[model samples]
Target: MPLHPRPRALPTAFVAVLALLLAAGNGTWATTGAGAQDRAGSAPRPAALAGRVIVTVAGQQDAGRAAARAEVRARRVYRFALNGFAATLTEKQAARLANDPEVVGIFPDRTVSVAAQTLPKGVDRVDADRHPGAAIDGVDRGVDADIAILDTGIAPAHADLNVVGGKACVTGDATTRDIHTHGTHVAGSAAARDNGIGVVGVAPGARLYAVKVLSDSGGGTISDVVCGLDWVTANAATIDVANLSLAGGGPDGACGQPTTDPFHQAVCNTVAAGVPVVVAAGNTPGAGRDIASSNIVPATYAEAITVSAFTDFNGRPGGGGAAICAASGAVDDVFAPYSNFGADVDIAAPGTCTYSTLPNGGYGYKSGTSMAAGYVSGAVALYRAQNPGASPDAVRAWLLGTAQPQRSGFGFTGDKDAFAEPVLSLGDGSFPSPTPTTTATATASASATSTATAIRTATTNTATATRTPTATRTPTATARRTATKTPTRTPTRTPTRTPTRSLTATPTRTPTANTTATATATATATAFVSTPPPTATVVTATATATATATTGTTAAPYRVAASGRSANSNSSLYLYDRKPATVWISNPATTPPTVAFAYLDLGSAKPIGAVRWLVGADGTADSFRVQVSNDRATWINLTANPLANGPTGTWHELRITTTARYVRFYVTNPNADPRIGGFAEVEIWP
Candidate 1:
């Protein structure tokens, strides 16, 4: 693993001899592959450049070229500028030529292969959705950034992915379209478009370029990989990020010196050009432990932002669906079973059953650290796009600093240092303006108005309006029921007993016979059960309790946003209007769509007790799940089963126990009429 000395210069005598041989036309080497040979009369075939081995020579560029040409018909690929030239030569010829003083080493072109590998959750988990300018003019705007994927090419026409352009290092023609799905999938994970038909990527707006080092069979060699890296380096200024999902060979200490490992050297040069690299922490299927020391190439390379996989078994914590593996407790953000981990891993992302784009116009699922690295690549693109002048070090710092701390029990069994790998948590790009105080103030006013309305109704209806403070305060079970059916009148009845206590008196003074009993009944009933306006006194008390469920809690109104919504009347804004009567309905087109998700960004992390929902007067989803996320990506499910009890015109409150900056309500399945979904309002409890 020790560093090797730099390549040495060739002898002047050897160079002269090689020049003489080339001048005498004594070096005639045939090319390899289909249609590689020149016509009988055509100028003697130029050295085959395709599929040629990159020969590292101990000489100056001109001398190395002269020596290679003298020994065999060689078409230079790298031009020996980096002390190496890819040339066409048979195994026997290469072996014979190695004895020359100018030729230092002859390595068989090793075939590198594509490493086979999502989504709003992964995007939100990394907080890419929170990136500044994510949405502009009513549409989600992608960052103006570019990333290169060095794999099995890409399908630029894939509907969900946007590939700018790329080069192929494979045999024959130079087309970068994906022959294998690996590169396509990796590309999708990193920058699939935000178009509604397929999955959205972590940075859906970034331009993607493919460096096809791997062939259709998912195999290529070290030389091919270096070729791809060289291309990436050549255009580093245009590519802010690069992701290498493929990994080969075991680690042999630190990234070896350039003289010993051209791959490392190429990657080093690429990073030096200001483009950050992300690579997969290679997988170890049955071992269930760290493989960092296995000498994984790009991953172990010091410049890479190595990423490991975490199995978001249920997509969100506490939620359930098909799992990548059997995992229990705190499974949402657990480390993936097959992921490699160790000191080298820089971070982790959801890689289990990640959904993304595929080649030939389709989409599919794959799981691996390859997918995880793509997510990081996308994250880096977002960061670079937002901070165009940021250096590689600054980008890495921001990425690492904002990562969410990992829990030890979350399925990770790697070294303690590996377990500490931070789960990526891209913070909201900017602090949201604090919600207006008028929002809460309005809720208080509504409570008071409802109470007054109820009392006035009582005054016009029953003589009990004049009952004693104690008598009016103690409502019998039957009376409470009637009060609920007419909530407006209920509060009036309570204060009737304390008219002497003043109509503006606190409602709690007239304690119900059993607060627990009242809560038990109302808690189970849909919020839609028509109730008289709550007396300002009692409503204030209940609201306070709901808001203060967590100690030192601060309740702020949230900004509502939906993946799909109807016209302006039912827009997402209505969800936060503090009026249970005002509703926000989804567009009919989104009913059974792939992702039926709506969210509220609270601007800042807050502890929430319950989420209140008013199912639309039109219809409600048969079942839906609520999830929470600090970064808006790695959502934690707050419920065990999707709630399906709401009927049209009913109000339901799901009691959740978690703290997050964003909360999402996802419809798991459509109703009888899938396209007919609606919601009157969604409220976060204080």
Candidate 2:
């Protein structure tokens, strides 16, 4: 079976427990291995290693040793090794040995994704600055505190991060250098130095220890995670905070017990050693289920301090207005649409569209509860620095006790209890005082130079609307590079007065052939596409009135109320005029590889029943959403996940029931074909 999208990865039990869980992390798209075998055949490519499995042996270290010997006797080849008496094996071999008396259990080694960055707003929102630093008194800023980031890894050379040292528990390497941007973003949010070039962190002075568990592909196995936990446990005396911006399966039960669940015990032991473990509550929406009952690990564990996510309405800390999701109320703080909430969530922080550092000294935006957890980890580091003698339980108590409770309710059910309690401020009167520095705006430019730790002299204007920055990739830990090669303009569609028809829709123009040379260099580094084709000119043709509408009858024509294209292009009005020949295209040059979206505002109120799209060029769109809204303020999702489209120029219609003045077509996930996204015609039925 293939793995479905979930927050972080799936859950895994110890050697005694047999079930294997495979869930994806925040904002990652995973595909099951269904391709052909390779030529050499010694080992399958990591991305397509479907037959690879991790087997756990019961008992103690002695039992693991016995299991290894038994596997050899059975003619099974074991690759990786873990402290929990586990080893990686072939699927067939694992099944054959599962019934062995010495073998505890066998399961698949599932992949997880990297799931970061308006991190300071979240920190300030939690009130972490009051206790110490230049603004207050004493030495706050996590001067002596250490946080162990268990993720893809940290860029050891990033000027913004004070990375003291780390280990690659999964790769068996000593250097914990990050190639993926996920871990770097988390590290920046938790502790990007006070250096002025990039964004600041809650504990800018904290020492970061990268415990690489997940691979650069953003996935890993229970064995790898177990290795990381064991390493942290051995060094718990020096590490004060452990940030787990990853997640997996729900717990079978509570965390107090160690017999049934090894994961629970692993995290529990770390906490018992006085190191506070902060985890993401997850981005999976609980829908109707009480989130408290959900089984997400680490977050659900009683010993771990779980953090949820909120949208800062104005996209700034303490700033208020409209939220990322229309369903969220108009306020400074509101629950993020993707955030998981319930009794398990101890605190909420800004997680939507947070801009932070990328792996190779670059910076961009990311969103998820994983991003929210980073803020809490920084706060924990600050608290630990201020009170070196405070126990984990005492620190957790003060952190939760001093939080500012939310007053506004979440959407639909108006559930306030699920996430009403959050950390709005953090500060204690225990530290010393000193110099004052002016706060700088947290923003990144298109071509930023990787500079040393220093404050920025120029300030960037804060953005309030939901905007995705260009895609970025960190090729190596020692160098810096931008994913986008050419300068691309922002796509725009502003609605005019008349409702009968919308203004012309514009598709991004093809970049010059020269642009391809620069783009080709980035393909190897970014995870957005595995094997990209050679430079091929992507052409989007104007759709003519050839195809007939299949879904809805013509209603008053609606123009684009608001639209955001990932790249700049010329405008074409034929998109909404019932024409089938004209098209709207997205620019593939957008950094951070973002999806395009449009909000159509009906000129007047009307009964909307269906929406149809004629997809061209690329036959499929990986993921998208159709949502309706009244007054362009509150919106409702009509479908979940992306709809599978047909071949080029085929019209796909979605039926819905809603009377609204606004409709939005948002591409939440990027298409497999990065160069082109085409829509020949859009039809709305009454």
Candidate 3:
């Protein structure tokens, strides 16, 4: 079976754990892979199809020993020599080929993704200074980009939250505020506006749409996480990205993770839709490898942009590396005392003294992988803000391509996490154009096949709303990538590797409160499909990056109020909670991604049983919807050619389910010639 979308890429944050947990710093992030696949709909390219045929001295370090020693000596395209294997491939690439028994598995040349983290300084209440770097730099401007935080809910009115729209999957509260401020904290870090008095955010100008999956008390079910993603899919209009600051389960090493988990699939779906998601590494070191097991859920979801936490020092005296800190045992992922370490980790960030948003009129400090995720989310916004023409995958590639290489332990081995600090750098939005060696190496070995991963076809209604992903691969210390020598392969145990490192510098001040000024929306008319697309052309321009947000809340003036009613099909703005309507003005380019939200009246609001539609008025069979009442039992809902009905109406196709929780099956199947469609939330009360 092809790997489903559910499998999450290792959290970039895990890399931080490696940076923190281990001594000998100087490790960097790795290069990101391509292809935006949805766990539920798309599948990892067939190992047979996506893989290539390449002979190598994999999993046999002994032949390996001669070959390994020889390869290293020749340096003719060589990498680190792990214990059991010595093939050439990235951690992700190596994991992709782990099943080939006869050939042996490859390993990443120090590939990284995520890291362990520290509690942030918490959202502080300070005033912003506009002079020079006094303002938020490298932050995502306030362009209405949907950001999802899979942690505790946000305090809807936190001065620092700058939250314009949100939905709680665990609490089922789409209206008012949430009790917990986890989401607010994460959201604030990724995109709090830089109003003069408040702390600036990474992407201050971006319009943040919060999707609350976890509960007020903190943790939540896998089902709620999945629903939260689904809700984001339905309302892409207001969201361009998502932040997942939580995880479940412990390490399941080696095979990476399975692609069949529902929560994994839901997150993959968002990525496939061209939206980027950021997830956290687990706070606890995984089950096995000291700090190996990664938190499940979004962290393991293949498409999420995972992050790791980093501190200011390099766990050693007078020995701080660039981005590596001293006394790291206390803070930071690179030297983070408690971060989970392994191939799944992607990148590291300043997690301590971090400031964003919090629950009440109150804000306090707490450390964990969550704070690290926020830092990455902020950087992702800047990447998008700088390159609107970049595809989600391409954007991912750019982030990875620019990461400074990080090393592990005493050896400079493996690839870096997919992303690292100084987060965004511009890149031509393009896929890896056929690398003969690298491409072919990924091909499946002609070995006996076993279960790739299970895909349960549960009753659409019977499946859990969100299912935590599981990894069948038994946790293996071998997968952790510590710089160990062959023969004994004992993990390099050095005095510097002590877990009890101290914090050299004190934590930074708390973050400032939110105070986004209200500004009018400005729409621009540019072509998105044009070759070398316009330079970050603004559809709703005012919402630029995090810094500008505090200056003013300028975005498309549109919203769906509490009492608004919709019949069969109606595309609404995912971020718009107001009563106005704003049609995006970007010219057609590659399939234009969009999202919107609406209320399902069922029978209460007299929406008299209607089906919903979003594709071109008459373009059915191209883009379609799969309907589900309970959100679990899903069936296809096709759009009949207008054939003379309301511009966009429901009920013309499939029917007889429930009246509430209706959502259209929206997609941009094609990539060329930008496709246009609107998302509509409707109810069919027959």
Candidate 4:
């Protein structure tokens, strides 16, 4: 007899009556006859089909009833990330449950396996070796952040690891101990203690939580993976970062939606709860050639930081080094041949011949995107330790913004897709200062006492000739005049001159001046001039002019608040970050040929006259539309007709006239081989 025998068939009339009753109880069926017709249209299968299925409940209140209606006992119930249960159900039962109003989705359980294919030098290559206490000196200085390794169980007794705690989700595994070596290798690559004897991880001594989702053989089901995420989400406050050195089957476009893709939903909830997830771009088996990273789960989700593998033979930037234990044709300092690529890949890291810890307190080398992701998790731990409450998006921004571009000396020879993603670098001096501080001095020589007022006026006029700087000064002059009688008297004598100077400045400064600087200068000047003496008035005026000059020094010609004011679907944050190497790729699975979009929020409604964007290597958009909106509900087309296709890796601009806070890009047809969409950077002009 089968483990799960098919249930006996029921009479059509009886099944129909049962369905109507269940629908009414769930408040999905109205007393009207039309409701009954709708229920009958979605009838269950005639015969039972045996299999395990995951049923995602629309709400916690519906779980019990939904399972009862299906007459199946749940094997596992998820709470934190997903409100659902895993159960064995016949095809007929699954179809009935899927029709339930409270059921979000029902997915067949699929096998998930470890993405093992690592390193001592991956740390040095990514520059993690430069961090304090990250060296292999046999001493544990201790790491401040906690990382969850969602793979096979970790080696609890390994001296080189600091496995603080863990939860086992796999069956027959009551303890969070590694019987297989994959999870142990991953843990060591991410946070192996900095001990002199063996090997040091990317972030030495980081607290490791072994959330074993895969069995000892390094294989499990989607339900098991979701269980691990549920555990992580429950303990999100304690886990700063999580790494999944594992992969399931093909991509799910509906991963962002609540109804489809349980793993994707779990990752989204985990990240939303403050724990950043880093996942592997699964290695392509057999062929040993690259494929789109979007072809894999978790990596296909935009919420997680998806990483691909690269080879760095000498553990340093710049090419010319020979490949060590890499696949044939794998070049040094380039993307690995067996690694996944394409637009979904956020970044790359040293993956070939990585040295790290294994099970039984052993040490060895492995190579694949799994190792690459582990290195990134370690980097994230290091970053989070310094930035205690940084959001997942902020961490992603930092990682991308600081990554080293793979161009010129950086090596892009083996990059199949040519997305040119930046490689991860954690050295202290690798990235630009987060809050770049620039000091600019503008000296305005007002003849201490100009005997001839006309000469002083003429000097101010000459300064105004430098349009950009003078534009910002006009407001400073008016602010000073309005705040004090002394400056007012001086300006009144040369009213025409003051007006001329202000007019000259308005054109250049009004559109691009930093509002914060102007406001700060105005407030400071007002406070100082409140009780001004003749000498104090002159000093304050000079200082105000200098402040005005400094205000424009850092302001870009046409600036948009691209920092934290944009949202996208099926895309990454790299689109507006102004980094050419960091490109945003649309999930081909999620993006339909007719419509795919990404938008920028200008913070508030403003005059937008033109848009400039750079395309990625995938291909150009065959037909694209630009729309603007104030509330993001009602949209007005900026382009009267769709823009024609253009070349890739080059800037394209669209001229338009509109006022809106939100500027949206709609790709009607992405003219690429895979029907994907992408953008390297976008700039809005006023």
Candidate 5:
């Protein structure tokens, strides 16, 4: 039978946009990895260990001789929701299909950069434009272009983001309505209309194409993701940018990595054909690599622009509404509470307390690097809308070309303003080599007083107190259980002729010999088990000097800082600013309680937000704000902090972290004040 103009909704469990991802998720990815690879030829290439995706052919391949040819090529390959093809091809089979003219293309299972958006300070409630929607962040906000946000799904009914071009994969019995609130939220961040409604997108007028990758629960593999990429690459002519707010087990985000990896390769394929693939970095901090290092996959590739997340200080609920999403603090990329972060993270953007559209037909708030990445996607659309003839490389050069310099702070902390250059002010690409130049910006006060904005002219100012990042090489996994015990063994032996004048009679090994042999065998097995194999688990963070903000002194049990408060269910882990303190109770039955502050700093956030399992030991199990007298010995902050409740669910702790010496303590009041708890690193920027 011949095919029709458009393929009907096949009853097969193919990949359609899963329910718009309502659950989630940036870094601004930037680099030219070609030089890096050329230099790294001696080193073995990083293992391609991303989860798998299968390719199908109309026919099967022959084994020994006269192999069969692929009769028909698949139009698109799906990922996340739609999974497992009937045809499981080996490397050779896959090679054959890749080379086949009839075959379309082999795609990866999922998009790189699943951890793009950092979880916002507020986990429970979310809505776009908490206050006013004005573009006062030094960037022109109005423009139109074509952008496709492939995620869970979107809510077309949302007043703010009246997105056009909404469609789902609708492969199976799934009615193809937005199930997860994710897709709608992401789309709203990217393409929400400028109409006086709820939220304002980065590029409000930009055309939208909703593409679902993950399912409603927000779990997905790689297949459906590849299908969405294929669609973008094929439709590059119509699409100025394709915002992929998803990642697999590996790297890349909101934009595909330029180097390799299936997703990044697809991004490269699109780049070759003049399209840009934007991706999300993911939600795992410290779990990923450093912002400039290895937390790899496509997002880290040179071509992609990974966007990190931040809270909207301008849109603080009842205050002024925000236009372009932006945060005003040094903890910009300080890792959203739940966002996964690492060195490969490129840049950061607004993600906290974001309100957007849902596919089913309503609106909601989404907090993750996913929201930040959407801002970049919309920005790209606007840029391409203005400069349609710009090359992929040119666009890449321009984004980083005009990116503001965000310095990584001291002590394994992440970077906030790494890509903090205002978009409108950014239009030039100067850094053509490994050494990127930093454009200056204003270091504004919390009150946002009218200060002299840091002007970044064509002047060369390398007078930077930038701390060179140091790599820590502690093996992530400890030794596994080694079996050690005496065991009985059986052995067979034959005696040889002695070197005496006469041949010696052989003593046959009997029951006693068997027992000794058994002991030897057991010892050998124990020794073999004792040795550990090399399982790589690298922890990435760049904590340098971070200046805590002195949020005006407040009373106890407050949610003032949004983050850093124990009273609230979730605390924003970005800034070092002091949060209102709550009380913690001491009970004989219950152990001491401590507040959590993530140390993930820099362009991307870090992991190590919460300490290990609670323990009696004070040092390892507490959260601290150190009062650095000299950078070495420090005092513990948050001591005797007030608590909101009886410390059943959790306790509230707050401290005013600053640039110089200050009164700092830990969350522990029962413990000696001389003994400080712990402090996860935060960040400061240029």
Candidate 6:
């Protein structure tokens, strides 16, 4: 006989809102006596409530068994974010659980929906396009951070995204693949790669982890959402940031201690684990407009960064642009008409007509506070890349601190609540250099010694001449070839000859004792026409003298006074340190078509023959140029064209003949792999 499989557990009912309103206890209960009747009779029991309820336990215990002890079937158990479980329970069963001292509170499971309606220009609206590290253009350089999208699963096959991994918490869904198109759209807005394809995201190329909480219909219960949060908290070490573009209706109140709001408690726990959460201020349906505190969940939680929506048709700050959604009454540079607003909202971002990737390798527009939250999530990723270990509170502070305030020309005209929240802006795209840990030093020694030997032969044929004792001389035909090549070779010989002539003249000025020295000098000078060996020797001597004339200068080895990023005092001494493992890296440019530069300042001007560097662990540069500057103000390129196709973990050498006080390395188009451009070691040879 074949056995039948057990039925899958499901929620009994889906409520619209789950409010947290604790009631005073009536009396103690005794299971074996009339006291139990008195306790049950004291409170006016509402007609047996039956549905799926979320039970928040007081401590970290077995949540599933806790529900079982109350005679309910647990559908899901949450461990990391909240010590709780979701179970199907009747009124008496839920009441019995509430009486247990270990149980915190029990509330009905509510519905949650995706907050989206979307675009690429939202990236520009947040000024992420202006940041070099953002790489908003279709460049390969990706943000070096991971972002988790908690929504209806992402499209696993989306070509434009770097979907690393995911987890599915919704019922009957084994994979975190988007069938609803909402989570995929949200993922694209947060970090679609800048691969010159369909569209780019705010934080281009950040690793995306899909945490599927909602289902294909773009809806799910609070239990499903909490299940996703539990997964996020468990993997908090790998996730740098999280984006929640979904919302639910609920009473606004503080979580923990006196009150028990499971959703808010889960969000707080997630933030405390170091992963910053960015959430959307919900959208009101139809023509209804309400403050965010009225219906938005997680938005009311102070632990997360709540984002409001603003319309930007032109991707700029000024008003008067054409409205894309005239039906919704959206005006350019103003708060989106359908967005929820109130003191709970932390910031605003572009959410109108957001162009982004959709399911099945497609792309389209979505409009909602969900899109706004995505922009903020991308910005948070950029920050996390620069500050790897920043706390959630620190991330929030930096984001708000760098934002463009309404008073500073980013203000929108029509917020119903009149709250002047700062608008997001990725300022200048430059970040503070990482603190120095260890120092590495490089000592370059270069010496050129040229030795020349000249032999002149003469033959005379004697023929008797009566009066003058003169002999008819037959000249012997002699041919000689000599070539001398020094590591430091200048293309122009005119300047070299001038210095050679002056040095020769000085030796000839000496009196009788220096007569032979003058002849030898003349012979070396004459060799400039027939042979370059002697001339090269004289030029090398002259170069040595000029180098010695400067203070703190040495003959062959050159000493570097300092090294750092161009036009910045932040020390990049690791570049000069001989250690190949130590590196000085720059944050990937938020925007593309920009350069990241670092410079080495020699104690004084010296001849630089070649620059050798080892590619850092982050990755290799796509193209680079070597520049020389006599004064740090003006620079001349030593390499006419950028060196391309750099290999990883290998030392690359660019041979050039130039003399300067400072040498700079410019990564014009950095490799998109690691995004952060840097060199492990740099050696400048004389």
lDDT against the true structure, each candidate: 0.51, 0.49, 0.35, 0.57, 0.36, 0.59
Off by over 4 Å in 3: 1-144, 171-176, 250-259, 285-295, 313-334, 407-686
* Candidate 6 C-alpha lDDT tens digits along 1-686: 11122222221100000011111122221212221222545532222224676777767667777777888778888888889888778768866775665666666677776765123667777777776667555666777777888888888888898988878889788889889888888788888888888888877888788888888887777788888778888887777787776555565445454134677778778877767778887777444245443545666666677788888887778887776544377778877877877766777888778888898898987888888888888888877676565566546545654566554565677776645666877755222222333221211122212111222235532111112111111111100001111121112222211211112212222122111111111111111111111111211112121122111111122435444463221225446443344555555445543456777766467765445566655344666656666555555554324454233455544433446777777666544543445676666655
What is the full ranking by lDDT, best candidate first?
6, 4, 1, 2, 5, 3
Give the candidate number with the greatest lDDT.
6
| lDDT value, candidate 3, whole model | 0.35
lDDT of 5 by residue, 577-661 (tens): 2111211112222443433222211211211111111111224323333221112122222112222111111212212222221
Number of clashing pairs per prediction, in order: 29, 38, 153, 13, 142, 25
Per-candidate TM-score against the hidden true structure: 0.52, 0.49, 0.40, 0.61, 0.43, 0.56
Candidate 1 lDDT, 202-310, residue by residue in tens:
7765677777777777776666667766776677557677677656563232222322544565666666666677778766564434434455655656576777877
The candidates, ranked best first by TM-score, are: 4, 6, 1, 2, 5, 3
Candidate number with the higher TM-score (3 or 5): 5
- Write the residue-wise lDDT of candidate 4 on 285-374 in tens digits: 433333332345656566677788888778766777775674566677767777766666677887778787888778877777888888
Cα lDDT tens digits for candidate 2, 1-686: 11121121121100000001125333211111232223463322122122433343444445445555545332122222222344555544443454354443334444555542233455555454453431322223335567788888889888778887776766455557788677888887777776556677777757788888777767776556766666777776677777776556533433343224545556666766666777786665433223455556655666677777776544344444554343322245556666666666666677766666788677877777777778777777665665563456545544543454354221112334533444434544111121222222211111111111112234642112223333121110100001111211112222121211111223344433221111101001000111111112211112211111211111322333222223332122223423344455555454433565554444345655446566644543566656555544444455423344445545454434346665655564454555434665565554
Task: Looking at model 6, report the run of 10 residues with the lowest lDDT sum.
Answer: 12-21
On lDDT, the stronger of 2 and 4 is 4
Compared with the true structure, model 1 gives a TM-score of 0.52
Model 6: per-residue Cα lDDT at residue 150? 84
List ranges where model 1 is wrong by over 4 Å: 1-53, 57-67, 73-76, 79-83, 88-104, 117-120, 136-140, 250-256, 317-332, 408-419, 429-686
Best by TM-score: 4
C-alpha RMSD of each candidate structure in angstroms: 24.9, 24.3, 25.7, 18.6, 26.2, 24.3
Q: Candidate 2 regions off by >4 Å? A: 1-60, 72-83, 90-108, 116-119, 133-142, 171-175, 250-259, 285-294, 313-319, 322-331, 408-419, 428-686
